[model samples]
Target: MKKQRANDSGWRGSPEVWFQAAIEILLESGVDAVKISTLAKRLNISRTSFYWFFADREELLSALVDAWKDKNTGSIITQSEAYADSLAEATLNVFDCWLDDTLFDSRFEFAIRSWSLQSREIQSEVKQADAIRLESLSRMFSRFGFSDLQADVHARTIYLVQIGYISMQTKESLADRMIRIPDYVKTFTGEYPKQNELERFYYRHGYKNNASS
Candidate 1:
């Protein structure tokens, strides 16, 4: 597999190769097998070559967290086009994409979450990612008529469910989660989701305009 290029369809030899290999190692053998030496062997490269891409294993892990964050959060914020007709649907598409085979890769998600438990740095990254996610989700809630407190509380539940699901690494299907998010959201807001402005906004852009405020 080659690194994707602006116009090319395959790998161009970059950190992603190692990152995916790391995920594979973690999934096939467990997080314990994702070390630099293991990754080198898995990738048929020298351990010293890892330094060319990352300073060390911790740095590589940091890069992995960044990749995960980009996959989960960054795309929604930067990609979805701002449009009137399908705005909400486009915004919330990130959650929907979580169901995709390439993106949803549950084993990798579970491994990342599991690794985060033992590494303070990883946990910190996860927390930061969650904070951004919650703020984004809260906006969608409020945009759909929920108040600040209500939106925040609802967002918290959603965050917990996602993390808890990863923690449990449930064998359930994405269809189940998609069906269940509405039920989960209804817990605090007392309203079910519809393909309205809010859902459109979330599908198009799942993000808080201002996290600092």
Candidate 2:
């Protein structure tokens, strides 16, 4: 825990402010680094101020897990349920999450997964999130007329690949990833996205001219 001035004379940070600071520490140095004293120094507030927003460290940690569930898992469920005219379009809608940080926080996801390795509770939460996300994806596929078994398999394929990317922290240039998007979509959905659909996806990601189609 790095030391800094605890300028908590009159300023008390809100829950969101405290949570964001904790998230920064968690992402930068893992969960163990997210201490009240450290956060106070980081936020320039008193260590006691943390209690104004949370009962204790465990409460704050619980909030972090809840936020992870709401953001990452919730994003997947939302995207899976988003309307699309075709399976390819539906798959692309889900893929939008990978390209858009506002929709999916990959670094946060990676950090939570890493934290799960040390805590059985977090590990269970991760497993539950995975099952829920997979079920949502399966439903997405089922909506396109796939049988339950086929939908489950395809959903797993799509999800496991993305999880592999996050777990491995795979890096690829935007152009490189863009070049592969169509094929990946095809592989996931068994249908290549049409040129117009690709354009829409690219535009949504602010890469309108990057569409291979």
Candidate 3:
């Protein structure tokens, strides 16, 4: 039998490796930088190896968008639906996404929004995500006894404010943001979080000190 080189012996990188490398490039540069050759170079593998994982650059890009939908949009829907004893507590659940990167990837959201400017398909996706997210928030508010109009208005207020934060690239320390959570919950839900509610929220985020209004 002839000797086979490691590269020819199925040394292609895994799908996750290519997908993550693509995301890194997308985040670091922009959508334009996410190319098969670029990713292959970054992974230090044969260009052909990419084909084993993705059909083309477009497929990989689509996967990235899907990931954004799952992580960013999905997180809000999940958090909005989480069980809470009061509207204030429910609002805090949604706020967890803003504070925790694991629940929501703000950098990925920013990159996708930037990519939307170049692709009408992605722009439509972003718009649809906004609608879906807003609807979920509205439902969350309605569950707490808000009228339809009130729910819609409050939903927009919360969603738009968070989007504004991501779009503006606002930076605030965790402690500073923590101190404002109770007021934010009150402002959004028209009900201040109880002391116990605030304590639970702080505990969930591993904050040692309770936030004060």
lDDT of predicted model 2: 0.90
Better of 1 and 3 by lDDT: 3
Cα lDDT, all candidates:
0.60, 0.90, 0.90
Q: Which ten residues in a row have the lowest lDDT in candidate 2?
A: 1-10
For candidate 1, what is the total of clashing residue pairs?
Answer: 20
Writing each residue's lDDT as its tens digit, candidate 3 over 99-191 gives 888999999999999999999999999999999999999999999889999999999999999999999999998788888887888788888
> Which candidate should be chosen as best, given lDDT against the real structure?
2
Cα RMSD, model 3: 4.4
Per-prediction count of colliding residue pairs? 20, 0, 0
Q: Where does model 3 exceed 4 Å of error?
A: 1-10, 210-213
Clashes of 2: 0
Select the stronger candidate by TM-score from 1 and 2.
Answer: 2
Query: Every model's Cα RMSD, please?
Result: 8.9, 4.3, 4.4
In terms of lDDT, the poorest run of 10 residues in model 1 is 204-213
C-alpha displacement of 131 in model 2, angstroms?
A: 0.1
